[model samples]
Target: MDTPSAAPHRMAPSGGCPHADNARLLARGAVVPVVLPGEIEGMAVVGHEALKEFLAHPDVAKNARHFTALREGRISEGWPLLTFATVQGMTTADGEDHRRLRSLVSRAFTARRVEELRPRIEELTVSLLDDLARAAASDGGVADLRHHFALPLPLGVICELLGVEDRHRDRLHRLSGHVVATDIGPQQVIAANRELVAVLGEIAQARAEHPGDDLTSALIAARDEEGDRLSQQELIGTLVLMIIAGHETTLNLITNAVRALCDHRDQLELVRSGHATWGDVVEETLRWDAPVSYFPFRYPVRDLTLGGTVVPKGTPVLAGYSAAGRDRAVHGSDADRFDVTRPRRGGAVRSLSLGHGAHYCLGAPLARLEAGIALEGLFTRFPDLELALPEGEPPRHASFVGNSVLTLPVRL
Candidate 1:
């Protein structure tokens, strides 16, 4: 593997075109200093080795409350969405707090639990495919596969797992859109977050009064050997985390995979010819066009040196997962090429798309299972699936965090 070039100091765009901005910085080297939203200065760590190390480092913390700037009141809470990303959740917690939250949630969201949903996932996939076929027939043999198929499967599965009421699904879905929207203003973000929190809080309260077999109910009833249980706030946060992380990322995974397959005819042919499995397509998509381009900000507790760069304390850093996924040093010079038959490294699923270290995605198994089933069913049902806009370009969600197509029009 070759070493990344020296880190560069650069100013990231204040807003708009974040993907392009990130791509420019990533091209500079593995580690670069950047100014994020609200003029927060930090380092962007790219490449496989550098990201892995950054994620695992003890001093490179996730708790924003512990950030030196926040502690000393150097910066106002200008970004309301930052609260959603870094408050009372496992995603932003550190040490014992994170361990306790993760432990409780893990009991309710285990691999066996996810595996049990496989049959139901398959059933839902078939149902959605049927709906897509009807939609295509009505729309002159063309339909937005993303809306009809990719988006709904994971949303339905997650709602079922969390026991979200059927009536509330639409509201939850809309609010979630605002939560992840890159163009939304700070006030709008806060408004969306407030509504989402209220809904989750109500659901948590209801689950407390009357428990059920769903994961939300299980979480409400869960207790450690020490009798430690989740607080009401913790419960709400956990449910929100599960819903957003569970379905949103999986939706992108499916959409991105489908788009990749459609764009690369040769790779698509390999899978269509039965020379590669759907699982291969899913993994390659994950590595080539990661669903979450950058993991949310991780703040350093103190000044630290990482990947040959000195990062100041309280700086908000993000692991550039999208760039690392295609780093030539790690995946070879052909890393930029999308190849479904790319050999697995030691038979381990190595992409940072799902995350790494202590904060590794708890919902990874479920996401992978859902995507695999979705792709297999989708292609098997519609053997003639092709991009409706082959001559046109697909628009991306305007998010630094989310790397998803706005719509994937297809002919079924």
Candidate 2:
């Protein structure tokens, strides 16, 4: 598809409206499907009905063979795939096991706990932005936001939490990106997993030797408990998850917030004026353009009809969690537009970005806290901040699992 010397890439053909794509795939009443045309071949499901079948279908299991010989062709990269073997061994373990594993760290992400961390998060955000401002001023008033702030906040937070040294943060970034992004192939995932696992093993081993006030130490305590707690392997997996989830996901959150604020200067100024709160910005950013464009583990457990079309069992049904945020039935005509004042209707205690139902993201609270504080602190420190290079198309992440921006080059 390209010249011999050209770099290879994936192409997603788009219709003008993103909301329509999802509504078309699934919905009823005031329905509008937002789906990419021709992306999935031989699929009769289109628009509202399709979307309903996906989210509410019991038969549509998240579990599927990585390699499926579908009439549409081979469908690899399903739940429990080899790439995630390192993160979730029994990826299909949907019920008790999943809950138990998630519970080990879930307590830390409760509203009270996350709210307690807000002050610290705000301080960290301010510090990072101050550093960014200095760098921008020194570099002729231009700094890459990703390099200066987006990457470091989560990196430092997780590193401090996990007991990983600052010396090897670079390696973590490379490994994290390789596994999360499709730009790298299977071999890269294996190597990164092995290396990261080895590092976690070492750190975990040390925590058992010399405990500290950190997540690794906490995990060590959990593992050493006489009763049924975390195993050594779970320790490794959670550490990897924490580092990857903390950094990769939050990186996108920060970038997406920056992108949204820049695109809507009026909203940014209003937030700056205290007309809206940090929670509003965080909520709007998560909705306007989710850091995760797709849900990784959602599956069809049985035959289901979204809109009206029947999606057969074993069909790899992926929900656009990112897309679902902006539906008319859910959000109305202003769904496509980023409006911070929009009532918090969907988050009935659980934000859609974190997801819904049994397998909700455990890190939601911490993530929201981090983003809210990060945005507020950064803006407070640099009121005149604007993108260093605002023109042209912004960089997007090339990965199936994450909705991330590769780089956010900006001027403070």
lDDT of each: 0.78, 0.62
- Which candidate has the highest lDDT of all? 1
Clashes in model 1: which pairs?
A: none
Off by over 4 Å in 1: 1-23, 74-80, 223-228, 345-349
Q: Whole-model lDDT for model 2 versus the true structure?
A: 0.62
lDDT of 1 by residue, 1-412 (tens): 1133444444332223244555566566677876556665557788678888889898888888756656766554436346645557798888998998898778655878888888999999999999999999999999999899988898998888888877887788787777666566777877888899999988877776887778888777763223466776777778878888888899999998998887787898898788888888888988888888766678778887776667788877877888788877788778778898885446443788788899998988888899999998988888778999866577777666777877889998
Per-model C-alpha RMSD: 3.1, 6.6
- For candidate 1, give the lDDT of residue 67: 66
Q: How many clashes show up per model?
A: 0, 42
lDDT of 1: 0.78
The 10-residue segment with the lowest total lDDT in model 2: 29-38
